[model samples]
Target chain A: MKTTPLAALHESLGARMLPFAGWEMPIQYQGIVAEHKAVRESVGIFDISHMGQFYASGNSVADWLNSLLTNDTGKLGDGEGQYTLLLNEKGGVIDDMIIYRISADEFFLVVNAARIDEDWAWFQKHCPADITLRNESDHFAGVAVQGPKAKAAWKAVFPDCDLPEKNGILEKDDWVVCRTGYTGEDGFEFFSPADQIETWFQNFLDAGAQPCGLGARDSLRLEKCFPLNGSDLNESNTPLEAGLGFFVKLDKGCDFTGSDVLQKQKSKGLKQKLVALKATGKGPPPRGGYDIALPGGEIIGQLTSGGQSPVLACGIGMAYVPIELADLGTEIEVVVRDRRYPLEVVKKPFV
Target chain B: MNVPDHLKYTESHEWIDGSEVVTVGISDHAQEELTDVVYLELPEIGRTVKKGEAIAVIESVKAANDIYAPVSGEIVEINEPLGEAPEPVNNDPFGDGWMFKIKTSNASEIDELLNADAYRQLIS
Candidate 1:
């Protein structure tokens, strides 16, 4: 398995390592609960180098990206980034990515590690001379500092470094800092040289930032009801059905590749939607692939993700159920280890 | 990491105290490995258990695990406190975190279990 530059540091900190999305990443240090609570209460840092990066240059870059992604790329100014989705011909989400506009003719795309090859090949298949795409995944290291006290810990290393207060972007030295995160916490994502990542990580840790792992990251995103690319949204699910329609710009008329099918789906309305559920009692945490049942004992949907939230102190999950049964306060059942537990469909934002 | 000298152990990582009532729970090493205990399901107090049968279920943050019986017995009492707060298993697995108390049907069954030193070598 490939290791990040902080592999030695993780081992020294007694982390439990596990293979994830093609890299050996720390699954937990101390423990998932302790690390998770630390992030919710204080600050946590994560090595996000396993994610893929792409550089798009040339004059046609913006126009080419505008036709490929679901969101409008023409609206992004220099040094701005927007969350978007690359969809298949059927309007199903192939991958979710952040498109960063580096200049009038250059852009940076950060995508899921598992979808890097597929996304790169898809981009190459439709490339024109006006756009030059290069896979730059190995050239940089990314670190995320999140939670309430994240800014304080990060400020110790680069006191003059100022992160964008909004979802825009800022350049710090040779690095890029963005004030956005998958976790529902105030944080900044730093993209710097691979050799310099460890130095800054240690600096933040020494300033009282906790070392979080994949486990805490998963829990944090789940609490925010953020859909993971493979788990909650996939090639078989449309962005509308996955509850990510807000990110898809249907009326912008950008002439994107998947615009026709997505517009049709939006007009026709979705059949199934992803909904959040809360367990009614203290029981075993629900798990993915568990069957969802109605009050009449009819199968309706299946769970995509479920766990006990250390921050919320309750059980929360995502499920794809029929639109009629997806309302808040709807009753449902989740089967765990051969026993069914009753649950209620709650409003979004499980936290 | 407490390994009670008087208790017996199993290769499956359970510890048993079989002098009178046979109290059983997971070993400290086992609990340490399954960190961040979240939810637990213990058998009813009057439930009869057979050797090697799963009597309780433990859920950590990562996954769920089954706790098997060390000897054939009837459960007499259970640590209900774990249902409210399961982190004690991570804090003190051998003492306050003991799972259940079982009244053994056959006292001779304890002889087949491994002692403290034997259990230490088994885990090692």
Candidate 2:
């Protein structure tokens, strides 16, 4: 299995190791709940080096990106980024990504770790001869330092460098910093050369950032209602149905890969909707594949992503249910083992 | 790693003490491996089971692990407090963390369990 540069460090710190998306990664350090609370209360650092990075540059790079991604690239000024989706011809999400316009003719795209190979192949297959796209997945190591204390920690490490505003990117010789993160907290993501990432990680640790793992990362992101690709998102569901229509600009005046299907779906209507669910009573944490039901106890669907909310002290999850039953405050039930528990359709960001 | 000298262990990491009314709990190694004990689903008292039957569940933050019956018998008691506060499983797996007490139907099953030394080697 592939391992990150901090494998030895994680072992030394006695982190619980698990296999995720074919990578041997640290699932938790001190503990999942503790690390999660650290990120919520103070500062925490996570190794996101496994995610794929691509640099695209050309005289017409903006137009090329606009032709493929769902978000409108024409609105992105230099140093700005936005959450976007790459869709198939059927309007199904292939992979969600963040593309940052580095310059008028250059952009940097960060894709999901599990979708690296497929995304690279898709980009290469669609690239124009004049446009240059370079895959830099293995060249960089990523660290996301997040929490209320994140700005103070970043200041401690780079006293002279001013942090970019929200959704902003900053480029240096060996490091690229972005004011973005999965957790709904104030933070910045720093990407540096693979060999030099350890130094940055250690520096963040010294600046009082607790080392977190995938477990806490998932919990934090779930609390914020961020859809995880390959789980809450897949190639079968359109962005409009997944409650991500904000990222899909149908009125951009340009056609993307799935623009036609998206237009038709908008004109028609969504049959299913992705909505958040929270357990109303005590029970075992609702997990993925647990069956969900309607108000009358008719089984409808299975949860795509579910877990115990370390902050909320209950089970929370997301699932695609019939549009009529997706309204907030709709009473529902999620079956754990053989018994069902009270579940309610809730607003995004369960916290 | 802390395999108590007096406790007999099962291959699944549970520890049983006393032959007639045995107190059962997970080993220290098991709790350490399952960090952040968040929630637990305990079996009802008076439930009778056979050897190796899964009777309860222990949930960490991310996953659920089953707690099996080492020897078939009737469950006379359970760690009811764990429903609200499960950290004792991680803090004191052998003492305050005991899951249940089973009144064994066959005392011979006790001899089939591994001794402290043998259980230590299984984990090692």
Candidate 3:
């Protein structure tokens, strides 16, 4: 398995390591719940170095991205980033990504770790020859500093560097700091040279940022209703069905991939929708592949992600259900291990 | 790591420490492995359970695990406090975090359980 630059540091800190997206990554350090609480209450740092990064630079970069991504890349100014999705010809999601507009001609993209190779291949097949597409996944390392105290933690570590505004990217020589995160908090993601990542991680730790892991990352993101690439999204699912229509630009006037399908889907309502659920009674926490049913026990769908919310102190999850059952306060049942758990469709950000 | 010398252990990582109405709980090593116990489904009181049968379910943030009965017995009482707050199971597995008490006629089964030294070796 592939190891991040900070693999040794995680091992030295006694982090429980596991295989994720072909990389041996830390699943937890102190504990998943404790690490999760740290991020929600104070500051926590995550080694997200295994994610993929790419550089696209050319005179036609904006137009190229505008045609490839579902979001309006043409509107992005320098130092601005947008959450976008790469869609296939059928409007199915290829991958969800963050596009950072560094300059008029230079842009950067951070994509899911597991889809790096596929995303790179897709870019190569469609990118114009004038646009220089370089996969820098091996050379860069990323660490997300997240929580209410994230800015203060970063200031302590990098006193002279200015923190970027929300969805903004600040480039300082070799380092790129972006005000973005999966956890719904005011945080920054730092991308640096691979070799210097461990030093940066140590500096953050010394500055009082608790070290978190993938387990906490999952819980934090799920609490915010952020979709996981493999579970909540796949090649067969579209952004519209995933409740991510906000990221799709159907009327951008550019003939981009999946525009026709999304435009049609927008006009006609969706058949099914991803909705957030909260357990209404005491039961086992729901998990992926668990059956979703009506009160009468008729199966409706399956959960994409589910767990006990550390912050909410209740079971929370997301599942795809019929459009009629997607309304808030709609009662449902989640079958976990042959037993049914009562749940209600509620709003997002369970915390 | 905290295997009390007075307690007996099972290969599945449960610990028992009593004569007739024995107190049962998971070992420190088991709790450490299942960090941050979030929810638990304990067997009902007076439920008859056979040895090696799954009598409870313990959930952590990442996954769920089945907790087995170490000996054939009837559950006399369960840890009521655990249903509301299970962190003690991770914090003090050998002390106030006992899961339940089983009234059993098979006192000879206690002798079959591993001692502290043997349990430590099994984990190590």
Candidate 4:
């Protein structure tokens, strides 16, 4: 298994290590709930170095990217980043990513950890010969500093560096700092050389940022209703059905992969939609493969990801349900073992 | 991890104290591993349970674990406050976080369980 540059530091901090996306990574430092609360109330740092990074540079980079991704890359100004999806011919999402426009001809992409090889192969197949596509997944490390006090924490570490605005990217030396995160908080993701990542992580810790891990990361993202790549999204599912249509550009003037299918689905509407479900009564928290049913016990769907929401203090999860049953406030049941617990379809970002 | 000297423990991480109506709860080591207890499902009063049978369900932030009965008995009472708030199981697993009381006259069964030193060795 791959280990991040800061794996030693994580061990020194007594983090519980677990295997994630082919990497041996820390799952929690103190505990998931405590680290989760630190991110919500103060500041927390996550070593996300396991994720994939790539650089695309060429004269026709914007035009090529616009045709390759679901979002309109032509709309991204320099120093801007947009959440986009890479889809297959059938409009099924291959991976979701944040594409940063560094300059007129240079763009940086961050893809999911497990999909790096697949995404690389896909890019190579369609990329123009003149375009320079470099996969820098092994050379760099990434860390996310998140929470209400994230800006203050950053200021303490890099006093002279100005934090970027929301969805903005700032290039400094070999690092690319972006104002984006999976957790619903004011935070920044720093991409730096692997050798210097430990120093940066330590500096953030000295600045009062709690060291967190993947366990907290999952809970925090789920609370914000952010769809995970493998759990809530896959090649078998489209962005529209996953409730991520806002990021898909149907009429961007370029026919990117899956555009036609997505356009048709948008116009005709969807048969099933991903909806957030909150446990209404105290019971075992819904988990993946748990059955979603009506009060009469007819199964409709299954949870993609489910767990106890540390902030909400109750069980929360996401599941794909029929369009009619996806409405907010709709009552449902989640079957755990032989018993069914009352659940309700509600809006996202349960926190 | 705290393991009360007077309490009898099971290899599965449960503790039983008192004689006739024994108070039962998970050990501190078990609570530490299952961080941040969120919800629990307690067995109903008057429910008859066999030794080693799962009598309760505990849900932490990441996963859920079953709590087994330390010995055969009828459940006399359950910690009602845990239904609304389960943090005590993480905060005070030995005291305020006691799960249920089982009415059993089987002193020999209790003696068969591990003592504090034996339980500590099992966990280590």
Worst 10 residues of 1 chain A by lDDT: A163-172
| CAPRI tier of model 1 | medium
Q: Name the candidate, 1 or 3, with the larger TM-score value.
A: 3
Q: For model 3, what fraction of the real interface contacts is kept?
A: 0.78
Per-residue alpha-carbon lDDT of candidate 3 for residues A37-87, written as tens digits (9 for 90 to 100): 999899999999999999999999998999999999877989999999999
In candidate 1, residue B71 scores what lDDT?
87
Candidate 2 lDDT over residue span B26-117, tens digit each: 99999988887888888899999888999989998879999999998999999899888888999999999999999999999999999999
Encode model 4's per-residue lDDT on A180-245: one tens digit a residue: 999999999998999999999999999999999999999999999999988889787899999998
Task: Show how many residue pairs clash in every candidate, following the order shown.
Answer: 0, 0, 0, 0
Model 2 agreement with the true structure over A83-147: per-residue lDDT tens digits: 99999999998999999999999999999999999899989999999999999999988999999
The number of the candidate with the highest DockQ is 2
CA deviation > 4 Å runs, candidate 3? B19-21, B46-48, B103-108
C-alpha TM-scores of all predictions: 0.94, 0.97, 0.95, 0.94
Lowest lDDT sum, 10 consecutive residues, model 4 chain A, at A280-289
On the 0 to 100 scale, the lDDT of residue A161 in model 3 is: 81
Error of 2 at A154 (Å): 1.2
On a 0 to 100 scale, what is the lDDT of residue A88 in model 3? Answer: 96
| DockQ winner, 1 or 4 | 1
